[model samples]
Target chain A: MKKLLAAVLIAIFSISALTSCGQGLSRFSVTYTDVFDTVTVITAYAKSEAVFNKAANAAHDELLRLHKLYDIYNEYDGITNLATLNRLCGESAQPVGKDIEILIKSGLEYAALTDGKLNIAAGNLTCLWHDCIANGTGLPTDEALIKAKEHISYKSVKLENGTLSFDDPKIKLDVGATAKGYAAERAAAVLEENGISDYLINAGGNVVSKGKKPDGEWKIGIQDPAKQTGEYRFIVAVKDKSVVTSGSYERFFEYGGKRYSHIIDLEKLYPSDRYVSVTVLCGSSADGDALSTALFCMSVSDGKALLKQKNAEALWIYENGEYEKTDGFKIYE
Target chain B: MNKKTIADIILVCSVVLIAAVMLIVTTVNKKNGDKFEISVGGRVYGTYSLSEDRTVDVDGLCVVRVKDGAVYMESSTCKGGDCVKHKPISKSGESIICLPNSVVIRVLGETDADAVI
Candidate 1:
């Protein structure tokens, strides 16, 4: 009977390790902005704060390393990143790192999965939009967008012998949508492998919660769409989940007193005006990031159709102040 | 002592260890008087106690006010000023972030650092 009681107690403790998993576990948070263009916060739990910091540093450094390798803008010691791949477009297929290779492969998979709604090969359209925003010229001329459509095919990318090649020299690959969240997922794994659980990794809008807080669930706030400035629409109680939010409110530029979002539709060669914000709840941050953007660009029916293949849920805030969410998604009352 | 007694003692020791750990963690993280940390560009810039009210000039671009046990943004350089619109934070782990300036302030309990790099 004593052994039986002890077994039951052990089972209960292991079941809710975070709730009663107290004592000996030190929880702390560290922020790093060495990459991802935005701040990344990872809260960790360990035997000691010093031990937690050391483990957190390892994860942060790994994210920085991935950032340098996956950067599409800057050349770090000429290591041949995505930008280099684009600059060397249509040339001989040069050897690339595994990170770039995996990303390209994932890009291809997501392209097919979302039916080209998420395209990394539409750099021409994205670059033109960037230039338009920088020059404050508002929307690009139809001629420019039409020209950009020519080089917007993901199929033009060629993978051979651990290298990548593009059929169209104008083709460029942009991984902005996937890089940050992918880094978060990777870094979170490092923390878990190091036996550090009960963490929250918020890389910009891409957030991943590993375990519950000692007090209770991790409360994640969904950014309010209607309100220009304030608290979130609602808080979500989550554990072992990834919450990624894509919104047009934060990143926008005004041209002729009209605000334009940065997300562009490859098919229309213009900004997608379907949704103001889309939050994807999934197991992986990479999927959440890409799917949030893809679903934001699609109609609800189409978004729901594609989401059937994956075990992920989505909540969409339409342009007309409407809320649409999957059945599994529940926001705080 | 008998073998059964020794086994019972081992189990008791394990339970005590876990209970002691729980006590340490709860006491260590207990919410103390108001203290908040200010971060710029993802680095800890300063930590201020909220006992006395003061205005913090954040690099001449933004101003933060700590008064009445609550901290809030009084002004900022960003056009959106979302940070300014955010509510004052006094609870532990609450944060206000300004993306344009890359500023983040989080409220925390009074816990000294074990190691600094």
Candidate 2:
């Protein structure tokens, strides 16, 4: 009986020790659900009590600021400011905010990099589809699409000395594809400047983790695209990296028994049916965002080649539900 | 061992636990001494740091100034400048939101800063 009692006590102590060892970090999250249509932000950090509070407050402020900068529907926003200034046909220069300029430049660069697969100036095509969906009608006619396509050119949107102008009055700028990622990057910079070392920012599905957990690496779960909730695929342990995934599963409309993805193909002026989702890991949220969108528009073979060339990593899930990952992904079971 | 020995051990363990808790609390308070500020939607809100004097301009929106351990919204385009209505925030989780300009102000401590998600 004495020996059995001792064994039980020892077991209890060991279990307690194991649990206590991994339980020092405090977690706080602020959810801003209104922006990005239906997207939310969940920011977590590990720090002392006071530090945690301070960090959370700062992050909340940053998120609100980013929303104002990126809201496409907000007519007074800088993106709209550009649109209004360029409402008349022909090139007319308009001064833009630094943040807007960076986003525009990034959008054009990504467009060129992905062979025009990801174009912010493709707003004309996007708007037509948006209107169709809003009105509960079918896709726009081919003739209407062609007319819209004439104004959908990233090359025509010029940027110089913090001024942006468009050659076409119908040309609009949509940063929906990359704005969240850019915001995450900027928020991370704010935290770094304030001396917060270990944190994770999850803007919708895009995640950026900086520093490491007490045990070393940050463990993140990549949700299964098929499931509405719960972890489906695998967990990744990383340090100081950003992981962004773009998928049709998040937002879409079904018409005539067919599911149309939200991500539109600039050249075809229609929804893409290439891959189910694309996940990219990189050092910056902006890069991860751009690459994830671009990869979704490319074939598996081409995406693989591009990832290899860029020395970046990706996980591609095809329409058949089969998935392939680049060699750089260190997925943990 | 007798009950006396068990009681003594329990007492020691309890004392150690309390001490650890106190130590953590002290560490947290120490790190939180500095005040940080954040502005959202062109409204200034945050904890005023005694050591640093800083000013932020939202450009056609608002300006926030922190000086001598107090922070205030100095100028704003919004009606009534109601962001100035709130008291200066020095602790964590305090915030000021300017709805018109879509800006938010917050305070942060050193260790709890960087988050990417």
Candidate 3:
């Protein structure tokens, strides 16, 4: 009987030892450069590398699909992507995929919500800025900007019965502002569907978190726009939230020693300098992305109503280094 | 006590000790990240210790310099020069990316936050 008792104790100790070995969650990360014209990094805590890789790859595939669907520059074979819609929608109603339809509808919703402050139909104006930024050329001529601005109206693009058409031939759709955040949100959903609870998806300026880390909540650092470096101006802890920032510092052109931001102001027909950067934290990354851009174009007072409508919080960083955050945003900080 | 019972007690205590040591080691290692990884075109190019300062040429596309436990892009053969203009990054998880050249230099240690946006 004594021998039996000893044997059982040893077995119990061995089992405890084994269980303790696997107690803590392991951290895994992967990076992709081919999506959304920017670097995407996915980090998570999981039981094993194999498990994380399965979920990460699935999330990556989803992002790639969204990237191709929303692409405006490249046209894939047999894919009626956004570029195709932009080219042929004016000629006739183009058959659209569900993904494109949803994205367009979401873009329109944001356009309407912001009262046209976040217009995706300003593709003509945005494309001009994109070209100048890519080629390191000077800013677009005032005459050219004004001409493109003439066609900037959200009502011109029509989506009906999974078909997209343009009432105005000059009206084009550019979803650059919301595509990354929307993709990030979708990728996070894929991770959650794979049973991965603790993960963070950083798609360039858009960050979406699904759950808290083993140690505590996930921490996110807001970049200092004036520095344009990896330095953080503030660090916030959060869980199950999406944080998105829009800044003019990342992509810009220099002309006559003056920097021109990529975000254009609708009223000025020029890049807006209202704020150096605007960051929004909310439940959906897509909403955060749109609000960040809209807030960057408008003042804090003008954006308060919009923020309250979406149940989101914001932090606006000015060029002079002054900053302001909503009351709720301070909770995470 | 019987010899067999004494041996079982010793065995249980050693197993517990080993588990404790392992837990401590892993926790300590996770807390200290003093290295950075560099990648080009989404593939890892190399990893360098931040403690050992050195200069690395990234596929003849750019120059990366690690000095005083901080890493920065010395020069790049791409337009915009944003990577070069970026400040030296010493914190774990901080990265400097050159989009035109598809070069990324990211610190590869555990950080306070999972990511910086």
Candidate 4:
């Protein structure tokens, strides 16, 4: 009788274990602030804290590597980063890394698609505005901006045989518009490669979602450009996708009671003001990043056509508080 | 019923009751929080209980206050007091970040969303 009771108890315990097999997977998160001049938060679900830590650390390291490669002002030892390429590529065809080669190729493609509105080669013009914003010295003079703009034509940037060269020595490259999103997408892959399938990488405003949780899809809140941070305009349910938002409100300087955003328009040689903000949902965060910035500089009709070409959906919020979203965007909501 | 059969039934019932209690405890624990966490420079500064109303000065760079089951930034030395102006966060995963000072105050519990972009 005693042996039979013991067997029954074992059977009950085994059944309970099988029923709660996946209960060990818990949500864990880590934050890093030293990359890309923004906050990077990785929230993931794993069986143990140790496993989550291992995966999150690997992702953070990947982000750091990409951050150093894309950095324009800072130079690190033993790495021929973008700054080095910018300085010497104008003189000769400089040997480049595969990451940079891919970035510049995609950047040039975006520049052509957007008619130079999203030009990575516009570093010369952007730097002038950057200096002004950094120093709080107000806006850059139109004279200096025009001179810098002349060096931005995409034809001047060349990449061949794993080498990058500039037709114009003065041409500089700024990946500000695309680097954070690209890095977030890469970091998400790093998490997956480390056996973390359920995760989300929020690199500032660029969010990349991997697999959904046991409960349901991840809910991502898009910030309202006219309101304060943490204030959401919409909450979208998604899995295995990227959502990126570009707004004139976050990084801007107030000059003469007017705001000049960081996203410059080559045609006007000033901040693009057609829309207050543009948010894009796509498979690649890099493409979403470029599209959001480009769409911010375009009209609603033109932006819709471009979104259709890429099969991406967008929500455009005009300066007058009116908003428009693509036909398919409502499905996520 | 036989004595052996009655004994087996009681054993299984007790085991099921214990498992249900354990599951309930864990689910409640994950969903509710009486504490909040503070991080600076991507490192956790400290965790404080929301049950106790107190003030925390973060490396002399900013001040955080816990009151009535909510947490908020009371003051900051950063150029913009955006953190101070932010609403008090009481729910899980709600956070207020002061970018310049690299200070973040977040409620400690399971969040509705995995993240906010």
Each model's lDDT comes to 0.77, 0.68, 0.85, 0.84
On DockQ, the leading prediction is 3
lDDT of 3 by residue, A1-333 (tens): 675566567667666655654546788888888899888899998989889989999999999899998999989997888888899988888888888888899899988988788899999988998899888887789999989989989998998899889999878899998889889988998998987898989998899987776557888888877565566788888788899888878677888998888887777878898888888999999999888988988879889889999999999988899999898896345
Q: Compute the lDDT of residue A198 as modeled in candidate 2.
A: 80
Tens-digit lDDT string for candidate 2 (A75-178)? 46334443454453245677778888899899998888777788988877888887765455787899988988888788888888887777665687777789
C-alpha lDDT (0 to 100) for residue B40 of candidate 4 = 94
For all candidates, state DockQ relative to the true structure: 0.13, 0.04, 0.38, 0.36
lDDT of 4 by residue, A113-145 (tens): 888888999999988887777667878888898
Candidate 2 chain B: worst-modelled 10 consecutive residues by lDDT: B108-117
Which scores greater on TM-score, model 1 or model 2?
1
TM-score of chain A of each: 0.89, 0.86, 0.91, 0.92
Ranking by DockQ: 3, 4, 1, 2
**Two-way TM-score contest, 2 vs 4, winner:** 4
What TM-score does prediction 3 earn? 0.86
- Mark the regions of model 3 whose C-alpha exceeds 4 Å error after superposition: A1-24, A331-333, B1-33, B75-80
Docking outcome class, model 3? acceptable
> What lDDT score goes with residue A41 in model 2?
41
Which candidate model has the greater DockQ, 2 or 3? Answer: 3
Clashes of each: 2, 16, 0, 0
Cα lDDT tens digits, model 1, A1-333, are 687578557545644553565667767887765667666778767788777877788898889888888777777785777777788867767788787887788888998887778988878788888677555676889998898788879998887768788888788888877887788898998888777888888887888888776566776777777763323776777789889888887566788877778788777887777888888888889988888888878888888877777788888887787899989887754
